[model samples]
Target: MANRLQHETSPYLLQHADNPVDWYPWGEEALEAARTQDKPILLSIGYAACHWCHVMERESFENPDIAALMNQHFINIKVDREERPDLDTVYMAAAQMMTGQGGWPLTIFLMPDGKPFYAGTYFPPEDRSGMPGFPRVLLAVAEAYRNRRADLERAANDIQGHLTEHFRWSLPETAITPALLNEAASGLARQFDEANGGFGGAPKFPPPMALEFLLRYRLRTGSDTALRIVELTLERMARGGIHDQVGGGFHRYAVDATWLVPHFEKMLYDNALLARLYTLTYQATGHPFYAATALDTIEYVLREMTSPDGGFYSTQDADSEGEEGKFYVWTPEELEAVLGPEQAPIVARYYGVHPGGNFEGKSILHVPEAPESVAAAFDLTIDELVEIIGPAREKLYAARAQRVWPGRDEKILTDWNGLMLRALAQAAIALGRSDLRDAAVRNATFLHTHLYRDGRLLHSYKDGEAKITGYLADYASLIAGLLALYEATFDVRWIAWARDLTDRAIADFWDNEGGAFFDTSADDAPLVARPKDAFDSATPSGNSLMAESLLRLGLLLGEDDYRQRAMTVLERFAALAAKAPTGFGQLLCAADLALAEAHEIALVGDPQVPAMAEMLAVVQQPYLPHQVVALRHPDQDGEDEVIPLLAGRTARDGQPTAYVCRNYACRQPVTTAHDLAAELGMAVE
Candidate 1:
C-alpha cells in the first residue's frame, strides 16, 4: 500500500511513497502520532537527487522485516530538505554537533516534540566498517527510549539548548576595510593547493563564491597571484571530468584532488553560480575559454533543465538504472560505434578516453589535450580540428540521447531560479546576448506571475501549484535577481519590484535588534529554533544575500534606510567574517561592495538611440563591480516613477548624456561614448 507521501508534492517524498516502511511526510500528523503513541519520531531528511538516499531506501526501507521494526517502534517521517530548509537547518546543526559531521540522508531520532536526541547519516542494512546497522541502531534507540525515558528526555533538552545557542552569535563592532579584504584574500591564498587548482585536499567542491572573491580581490589590488588562482582553478575544473564534455554544465563536485572523477549529480544552484563566475572571469580577463564555457553552461540549462513555462528545474539525479553514472559514462567501443573508427581515435585521445577506462571500466570524457597539441598531432590546423570535433560532439550527444536519462526533480524553487535569473540577466548584458535577456525576462515573469501572489512569494512551484511560504533566502535572492534584471535592461519596473520586496522582507524576516535576517519568517512552520544563516554553504547564506541585495538596491533606489540596515548587518558580522574569511565568501563580496568607493552612473537618453546605446554599452563593457547604473529615458516621464539618481538628469544637446558621480557628487555630463568612457575609467574602443 502507498504511504501518506503518495499525495505529497515533493518529488523526493513521492519517490518513497511505495517504501515498505510506512512513511509520513514531516507535519503535525506525524508529530501528533508520535506524541499520542508515546513513540520516538524517526526523521529522515534527503533530497530526490541524493544517490545514497536511494541506496538506503532499497536496503532498509524496502525490507519488510526492517519496516515492521520501524513501524512498531517509531513514527517514521521523511523530509525533502529542499522543501523545508528550516527543519533541515535546525536538525543538520544538531547532527553536525552530535556527529562532528553532517550529510544527506540525515537520520535523526526525535522525541514527541521536534527535538532530536540521536542523529546520523546513511546506515547500511547490515553492520559493516565499524558503523552500526540501521536495524540494530533502531532497536537500540527504541530500547533506550523505553528504558531510559527521563535520561533521554534530559539529553534531548540539552541538545535543543545547544542547537539554540548555536544561532546566538556575538556581534563585533568593526568597520569593513580594504586591509581586512586583503587579509581575507591572503588567508584564501594560503589555503590554495598549488599542485592542484582548488583549496585543500581531495574531494574538491567548486568554490564559486571563493573564486568570485578572488576575482574581485585581483581586480581591486591588481594581484597576479589572486588572478592566477582563479584562472587555474576554472581552467582545471573545465578540463576535468567534473565538467561534462559531451553535455554542458558541471557535476556536483569532483571526488578526487585532480578533478578527474565527480559525484555526478547536476544541481541548478551550482551551475547558476559557476556560470556567473565564469562570465565575470571572461569580462575581467578577456579569456575566450571562460566565455565559451559560460555560454555552454547556460545553453545546457536552456536545453535540459528549463520547464515549458520558463521555471528552471531543481536537480538531475546522480544514479540511473540503479547504478551511479551509468548514463553519463562511455566505453571506447561505444565511442567508436558513435563516431566511426577514424574519427573515434582522435576524439577519444582528445577527451582522455583510453583502453583502460578512468571510471569503473568506462571513460568519463574530459579535455586531456590542448587544442594546439591535438591539432599538431592530428596533422591538421586548429580550425580544422575544431570543425571536425564539433560535428563529432553533436553526433555523440545525439547517440547519448538514446540512453535513459537521470530522474529530474521538476520542482521550481524560488531561490534557485533567482540565482539563475541573475546569471542570465548579467550574462546577457556582459555578452550582448538578446536571447539570454529574453529568457531572463521570461523567468522573472514566470516567478512574478506564478510564485509571487498578493505581494508574497512562494518557495517551491510544481505542476502549476505553488507551495510553501517564501523564506528570507527567497526574498533576498529574488530581489538580487530583480536588481540584476534592472541593470541588464535598465527597466525601472524590476527595481520598483525589488524595492517592494525588500520592504516586505524587512517586515517579515528582519531581526531589528539582532540586525540580520533569519532563515525562517514569522509565519513559517515553527521549528525548534529559527536560524540566522551566516555561512556560504552549497548556496549563499540568506543573511549574506540580503546584505548584498540591500547594498545594491539601496544605491539604485536612493534609500538610506535599506543602506543603513545593510551596513548594520555587515558590521554585526564583521569580526566573525574577518576571522573566517574562507567560509564567508558571499559576506566578503558584500563587504567589498560596502567598502568600495562606488560610482553612480545615471545615463539620461532614449535607450533606442545609437549614441545612447553606445554610451550604455561602454558603461556595461568593463567589469565594474562597484558601479550602479540607472537609465532616465523620455518614455519614463512620470514624476513619481523617477529614481533618485535620474530625477534631475537631462540629455545634453538632445544627445544621450552620461552623468558619472562619486557618492552622488556629479561631474559635467558627457555626450560622446569616448567622453563617457573617460569619465567612467574605461578605455575608449
Candidate 2:
C-alpha cells in the first residue's frame, strides 16, 4: 500500500511513496500516531539527492520482512531535508553531538514526546564490515526500549542536557579588527594544501565560502598568500575530475586530495557560489578561462536545473539505482566504442583516459595535458585545436545525454533560489547579458507571486503549492538576492521589495531582547524550542547574512533604522565571533564590509549610452560587495535619492562622468576609467 508520502509535494517524500515500509511524512498525524500507540518513532531524514539515501531505501525500506518489523515497533516518519531544514538542523546537531559524526540517511529512535534517544547513519541490511545490520539493530533497540524504558529515558534526558549546554555558550564582547582577520587567514594558510590547493586532507569539498573570505581578506590587506591560495584551489578544481570538463558544472567534492575522484552529486548551491567566484576572478584578472568557466556553469544550470516557472531546482542525485556515479563514469571500452578506433586513442590521451583507470576501472574525464601542450602535440593553431576538442566533447555529451539521467529533486527551495538568483543577476551585470538578467527578474517575480502570502514568504514550492512558513535563512537569502537583482538592473521595484521583506523579517524573526534572529518565526509551528541559528555551515547563518543585507539595504534606501538594526544584531553576536572565526566566514565578510570605508558611484545619463555602459561594466567586474552603484537617467524623472551616496554629487562634467564618494564626501567628477580606477586604488589597465 502507498504511504502518506504519496500525496506530498516534496520530491524526496514522493521518492519513498512506493516503499514497502509504511512511512508517514513528518506531521501532526505521525506524531499523534506515535503518542497514541505508545510506540517510538523511527525518524529517517535524508534528501532526494543523497546517494546513500537511495542505497538504504533499496536495501532495507523495500524489503517486506524489514518493513514488517519496522511497522510493528515504530511509527516510521520521513523528512525531506531540503523542505524542513529546521528539523534537519536540530537532529543533525544532536546526532553529531552523540556520535561525533553525522551524514544523510540519518536514522534516529525518538520517544513519543519527540526527543531522540539513539541516532546513526547508513546501516546496512546485514551486519558487515563491523557495522550492525539494520534489521538486527532495529530488533535490539525495540527490545531494549521495552525492557529498559528507564535507561532509554535517562539517555534521552542526558542528550537534551548536552544540547542545552552547547547552545548556552555566550558571545564575547571584543570588537573585530584587521589583526583578527589576518590571524584567521594565517590559521587557514597553515591548513591549506600547498601542493594541490584547498584545505586539509582527503574528501576535498570546495570551501567556496573560505575562498570568498580569503579573496576579501586579500583585497583588504593585500595578502598575496591569500590570493595565491584562492587562485591555486580554483585552478586545480577546474582542471581535475571534480569539474565536468564537457558538461560544465562541478561535482560535489573530490574524495582525494588531488581534486580527482569526486562523489558525483551536483548541488545547486555549490554551482551558484562557484559561478560568482569565477565571475569575480575573471573581473580581477581578466582571465578568459575564468570567465568561460563561469558562463559554462550558468549555462548548465539554465539547461538542466531551471523550472518551467524560472526558479532553479534543488539538486541532481549522486546515484542511479544502488550504484554511485553509475550514470556518469565511463569505462575505457565504452569510450573506445563511442569514439571509434581511429579517434579513440587521441581522445583518450587528451582526456587522461589510460589503460589503468583513474577511478574504479572507469574513466572520469580530465585534462591530461594543458591546452598549449595539446595544441603543440597536434601541430594546430590554438583556435583550431579548440574547435576540434569542442566538436569531440559535443559528441560525447550527446551520447551521455542519451543514457539514463540521474534523478532530479525538483523542489524549489526559497533559500537555494535566492542563491541562484543572486548568481544569475551578478553574471548578467558582469557578462553584459541582458537575457540572464531578465531570467533572474522573472524568477524573482515568480517567487513573489506564488511563494509569498500576507506579506510573508513560504519556504518551498512544488506541484503548484507553496508550503511551510519562511525561516530566517529563507528571508535573509531572498532579501540578499533581491538586493543583488536591484543593483544589477537598477530596478527600483526590486529594491522596494527587498526593503519590505527586510521589514517583515525584522518584525517576525528578530529577538529584540536577545539581539539575534530565530531560525523560524515566533508564531510558526512550534518545535522543541525556538532555535537560534548562529553557526555558518554549508550556507551562511541567517542572522549574519541578514545583518549584512540590512546594512546594504539601509545604505541603498537611506534608512537609518535599517542600518541601526543591523548594528544591533552584529553587536549582540560580536562576542561569539571572537572565539570562532572559521565557522563565521559570512558574518566576517559582512563585518569587514561594514568596517571598511565604502564607496558609492552614481552615473547620471542615458542608460543606453555607450560611455555609461562601459563605466558600469568596469565597476561590476571586480567583486565589490560593499560598494553600491545606481544609474539615473533624465527620462526616469522624479525618482527618490535611490543613489544615496551620490545624492548631491550630480553630473558636473559635460560628458558621461562618475561621481565617486566616501561617507557622503564627494570627490571631483571623473570622466574616464583611468581616473576612476586610480581614485578607487584599482589598476586601470
Candidate 3:
C-alpha cells in the first residue's frame, strides 16, 4: 500500500511509498501530530542514490513487524536530504555530536520541537557485527520516552546546546598574505599519497578543488612539485576503475586507496567539478590527455544525465537489478560474446581484463598499462591499437546498454546544474566545441527562465515544477556559472545577471555579526542550529565559492565593498586554512586570487571580424586563472557601460583592439593577437 510519501516530489521520498511503515513527509502536520499525541518522532533522512539507504529500507522499513512498532510508538517521518538541506544540516550536526560519526540513511529519534535526543546511521534488522538491531533499538527508545521522560529531555537539551554551538564561529583578526598560500600548499602536500595518487588512505574521493589549488599554485609560483601532484593524480584516476573508462564520468569515492574499486554511484557534481579541473589542466599544460578526459566526462553527462528541459539530473544509482555494480561489470565470457574472437583478446589485453576478474569474478575495465606498453605486448603500433580499440569499445558500450540499467535520480538541482554550467561554458572555449557552446547558452536560458524567480533562485526542479527556496550554495554557484558564461562568449548580460544574484546573496545569507555567510537564510524554517559550514567536502562550500565570485566581481565591476568582503573572508580563515589546506581548497584558491597580480582585460570591436576573432582567441586560450576579461561589441553601443573595465575603451582606428590593464591603468590598445599575447605574457606563433 502507498504511504503519504506517494505525493512527494523527491524520488527518494517516493521510493518508500510501498513500504509497510506509514511515513509522513516532514512538515507542520507531522510535527503537530507528534506534539498532539505526545509521541516522539522517528525521523529517517537519506537520498535517492544511496546504496545503504536502499539496504536499510529493504531490511527494516519493509518488515511488517518493524512497521507496526514504529506506527504505534512514534510519528514516523521521512526526508530527502537533497530537498531539505537545512534540516539535514541541523540534524547531521546532532548525529555527529551524539554518535561521533555520520553518513547517509541518518536515523534520529527526536522530540516534537525538533531537538534530537538519539541519532545513528544504518541499522540492520537483526543484531550482528556488534551493531544493535533496529527492532530492539526502537523498543528501548519507546520505553525510555514513557518511563524516563525527564532523562530523555535532559539529554536532548544538552545535545541541542552543543549542536548549536558547533555551527557558531567567529571571524578572527588576521592578515592574508602570500605566505599563507605557500604554507597551505605544504600542508596539503604533507598527506599526498606518494604511492597512490590522491591525498588520504582508503575511501579515496577525487580532490578536484585541491588539485585546482595546486594548478593555481604552479602558475603563481612556478613550482614543479605542485604541477606534478596535479598531473600524477589525474593520470592515476583516469587509469583506475573509479573512472568509467568504458563509458565516461567518474563514480563516487573508491573504497580503497588504489582507486581500483568504486561505490559506483555517479554524481553530477563530481563530474562537473572534475571536468572543469581537467579542462583547466589542459589549458595550463597543453596536454592532449587532459583534454580528451574532459571531453569524455562531459559527453557522459550529456548522454545519460541531461533532462529534456536542458537541466542536468542529479545522480545515477549504484545498484541495478538488486545488486551493486551489476550493470557495469563484465565477465570474460560476456566480453568475448560482445566482441568477436578476433578482437576480444586484443581488447582484453589493452583494458587489463583478466580471466580471474578484478571484481566479483567480473572485470571492472581499467587501464593498468599505458598504450605503448599494451601496443608492445600485442606487436602493434600505438596508432593501430587505438584504431582497433575505439570501435570495439563502442560495441561493448552498446551491449552494456542492453542490460537492466542502473536507476537515475531525475531531479534537476540548481546547485549541481550550476557546477555543470560552468564546465560546459568553459569547455565551449577551451575545447572549441560549438555544440557545447550552444548547449551552454540554452542551459543558461533554461535556468534563468525556470529556476530564477524575481530576484531569487529556486533549489530543485522536476517535471516542469520548480520548488524549494534556494540556499546560499545555489545562489553563489549559479552566479559562478553565469560569470563563466559571460567570459566564454563575452556576453555582458550574463555578467549583469551574475552581479544581481551576488547582491541578492549578500542581502539574504550574509551575517553582519559573524562577517561570513550562513548556509541558510534567516527567513527559512528554524532549526536546532543555523548551519554555516566552511570546509569543502564532496562539493565546494558556499562561502568559498562566494568568496571567489566576489573577488571576480570586484575586479570586473570595480566594487570596493565586494573586494573588501572577500578579503575579510580570506583573513578570517587564513589560520585554519594554513593548517589543513586540503579541506579548505576552494577558500585557499580564493586567497590565491586575493594575493596574485591582477589582470583586467578589455577587448573592443566586432568579435566576428578576423582581427577581433584572433585577439579574442588569444585571450580565451591559456589558463591565466586570475584574469578578468570583458568584451564590448561595437554594435551594442552603450550596452557595456555597466562594465567598468570597458570604460573609455575604443577599437583603435576602426580595427579590433585589446587592452591589458592593472589597477585601472591600460597598455596600448593592440590590434593583433601577437601584440595582445605579448601584453598578456604568452608565446604565440
Candidate 4:
C-alpha cells in the first residue's frame, strides 16, 4: 500500500510513496501520529540526489522485516532537505554538535514533542566498515527509550540545551579595514593548493565564495597572486573530471586532490555560482575558455535542470541503480562496443580513457588536452575532429539516457533561484545574449509573483504551490539577482523592486539589537531557536551577500540609508570576520568596498547613441563589481554629476559623446569608442 507521502508535492517525499514502511511526509499528520501513539518519530532527512540516501533506502526502507520493525515502534517521517532547509539546518547542526560530523541520510530519533534525543548520519543495513548496523542501533535505541526512560530524557535535555545555546551569541562592534582584507587573502593563499588548484586537501569542493573574494581582492589591491589563484582554480576545474566535458556543468566536488574523480552529483547552487565566477573571470581576462565554460554551464541548466514553468530543479542524482557513477563512467570495452575499433581508441585517448581505467576501472570523461592536440593526434582538421567527437558523445549520452535515471529533487528553492538568476543575468550581459537575460527576468518575476506575498517571501515552490516562510538566504540571494538584472538591462523597475525587497528583509530578518540577520523571521515557524547563520557554506551567508547587495544598490540608487545599514551589519559581525576569514570572505569583500573608494558613472544621453552604448559596454565588460553606471536622458536630474559629453546629447546625434568623472570631477568629453574604452580601462581593438 502507498504511504501518506504519496500526496506530497516534493519529489523526495514521493520517492518513498510506495515503500513497504509507512512513511509520512513531515507535517502535522506525522507529528500528531507520534503524539497520539506515544511513540518516537523516526525522522529521515535526505535530498533526492544523495547517493547514500538511495543506498539506505534500497537496503533498509525497502526490506519487509526492517519495515515492520520501523512501523511497529516509530512514526516514520521523511523530509526533503532542500524543500525544508530550516528543519534540515536546525537538526543538522544538532547532529554535528553531538557527533562532530554531519552528512546526508540524516537519521534522528525524536520525542513526540519534536525534540531529538538521538541523531546520526548514514548507517549501514548490516554492521560493516567500522560502523554499526541500522537494525542494531534501532533496537538498542527503542530498548533504551522504553527501559531507561530517565537516561534518554537526560540526554535529550542536555542536547536541547546545547542546540538552544548555539543560536545565542552577542555580536562585537569591530571596524573592518583594508588591512584585514589583505590579511584574509594571505591566509587563504596559504591554504590554496597551488599545484592542482582549489583550497585545502582531498574532497575539494568548489569554494565559489573564496574565489569571489579573490577576484575582488585582485581588483582592489592588484595582487597578482590573488588573480593567479582565481585563474588557476577555474582553469583546473574546467579541465578536470570534476567538469562534465561532454555535457557541460560541474560535479559536486573532487574526491581527490588532482580533480580526477568527482562525487558525480550536479547541484543547482554549484552551477549557478560557478557560472557567475567563470563569467567574471572571462570578463576580467577575456579568456575564451572561461567564457565557453560559463556559457556551457548555463546551457546545461536550461537543457536539463529547468522546469517547464521556468524555475530550476534543485539537483540531479549522484547515482542510478545500485552503483555510483554507473550512468556517467564507462569502460574502454564499452567504448569499443559503441564506437568502431578505429574510432574507439581515438575517443578513449581524447577523453583520458585507458585500457585499465581512470576511475575504478571505468573512465570518467575529461578533457585531457586542447582540442587542437586531439585533432593533431587524429590527423584531421579541428572542425572535423569536433564533428566526429560530437556525434560519439551524443551517442553515449543517448544510450545513458535510456537507463534508469537518478532521482531528481524537483523542488524550486528561492535561494538557489536567486543564485541562478544572478548568474543568468550576468552571463547574458557578458555573452551579449538578450534571450538569456529574458529568462532571468522571467524567473525573477515568477518568484516575486508566486513566492512572495504580504511583505514576506516564501522559501520553496513546487507544483504551483508555495510554502514555508522565507529564510535570510532567499531574500538575500533573490535581491542580489534582481540587482544584477537591473544592472544588465538598466531597468529602474528591477532596481525599485530590489530596493523594496531589501527594505522588507531588513525589517523582518535583521537583528537590530544583535546587528546580524536571523536565518528565519521573528514571527515565522518556531524551531529549537532562531539561527543567525554567518558561515559561508556552499553559497555565501545571507548576511554577507545582503551587506554586499545593499552597498552596491545604495551606490547605484544614491541612498545613504542602504550604505549605512550595510556598514553597520559588517561592523556587527567583524569578530567572526577576523576569526574565520575563509568562512566570511564574502563579508570581507563587502567591507572592503564599504571602506574604499567606489566609482560611479552617470551618462545623461540617449542609450541608443553609439558612443553612449560603447561606454556602457566597456563598463559592463570588465567584472568591475565596485563600479556603478547609469544612462539617463539629458533632462533627468538628481544625479551627483552629469557628463558634459552627453549633456546636450540626443538620439538624433549621429555619434554619442561621453563624460567620465569621479566624485563630481569631470574629464574632457570623448566622442569615440577608443577614448571611451580608455576611460573605462578596457582594451579596444
List candidate 4 segments past 4 Å from native. Answer: 336-339, 369-403, 633-685
Is candidate 3 or 4 superior in TM-score? 3
| lDDT of model 4 at position 378 | 80
The lDDT of each candidate is 0.89, 0.82, 0.89, 0.82
User: Taking the tens digit of each residue's C-alpha lDDT, what string does model 2 give over 436-480?
Assistant: 899899989989988889999999998899999999999998998
Task: Evaluate model 3: give its lDDT.
Answer: 0.89
Clashing pairs in 1: none
Worst 10 residues of 1 by lDDT: 634-643
Q: Write one digit per residue (lDDT tens) for candidate 1, span 424-464.
A: 99899899898999999999999999999889889999988
Which stretches of model 3 miss by more than 4 angstroms?
683-685
lDDT of 3 at 622: 80
**Over the stretch 1-685, how does candidate 3's per-residue lDDT look in tens digits?**
8999998888999999989998999999999999999999999999998999999999999999999999999999999998888888889889988999999999999988888999999999989999999999999999999999899999999988897677776646579888888998897788888877889899999999999999999999999889988999999998899999888999998999989899999999999999999999999999999999999999999999988768899999999999999888887678789897878888888787888898988888888888898889879999999998999889989999999999999998999999999999888888878899878888888899999997899999987889988999998889899889988888888988999999999999998888788999778877777888788778888989999999999899989899988887778877888888889999989999988888899888887899887887787878888889898898886645679889899888888899999877888889999999999888767
Candidate no. 2 TM-score: 0.95
TM-scores vs. true structure, each candidate:
0.98, 0.95, 0.98, 0.92
